[model samples]
Target: MLFLVAALLLLGVAMGSVAHAPLPVSLVAAAVIGVWLVVFTVRERHSRRHSS
Candidate 1:
């Protein structure tokens, strides 16, 4: 999960630098991170509930 987020962040940086469009790159990265957080949080909650 961490790896995925890290990869997306790196990709975002690369794309922004290469394309010279920080705004779009930032928006994409923000969306990806937001979705990832929601999914990760839900999975963690489910796991914790099952464990107990």
Candidate 2:
């Protein structure tokens, strides 16, 4: 609930900033965020598997 709202807010802010950013900067930022999400997903999966 709160987390979802916060995530949505952050996403909106990020998107807004990205829209104003230069193309190259936006691309790099997106790549970094993508990598971060991948890493976060992998870690969460690993943690869950180990916990279970």
Candidate 3:
């Protein structure tokens, strides 16, 4: 699932570049995804700690 997301993101960036998406739009996408990843990591760690 993570690999799929990453592959899709790369595909989106490539297609967006080919189709002329604005730079800020791409930056914002990356930023949002970055935040999501950080949050997910934190939650996963917290959950693992509680489980063990």
Off by over 4 Å in 3: 1-19
Estimate, for each residue in 1-52, the C-alpha lDDT of model 2 and write its tens digit.
Answer: 9999999999999889988999999888889989999999999999999999
Each prediction's Cα lDDT score?
Answer: 0.88, 0.95, 0.90
Which candidate has the highest TM-score of all? 2
* Candidate 1 C-alpha RMSD relative to the actual structure: 6.0
Clashing pairs in 3: none
Q: Worst lDDT window (10 residues) for model 1?
A: 15-24
Choose 1 or 2, whichever is better by TM-score: 2
The superposed Cα distance between candidate 2 and the true structure at residue 26, in angstroms, equals 0.1
In model 2, the Cα lDDT at residue 8 comes to: 100
lDDT for residue 14 in candidate 2, whole number 0-100:
86
Task: In angstroms, give how far residue 31 of model 2 lies from its true place.
Answer: 0.4
lDDT of 2: 0.95
* lDDT of candidate 3 over 1-52, digit per residue (tens): 9999999999998887846868888788779989999999999999999999
lDDT of 1: 0.88
Candidate 3, after superposition: displacement of residue 19 in Å?
6.1
Candidate 2 lDDT at 40 equals 100
TM-score result, candidate 2: 0.70
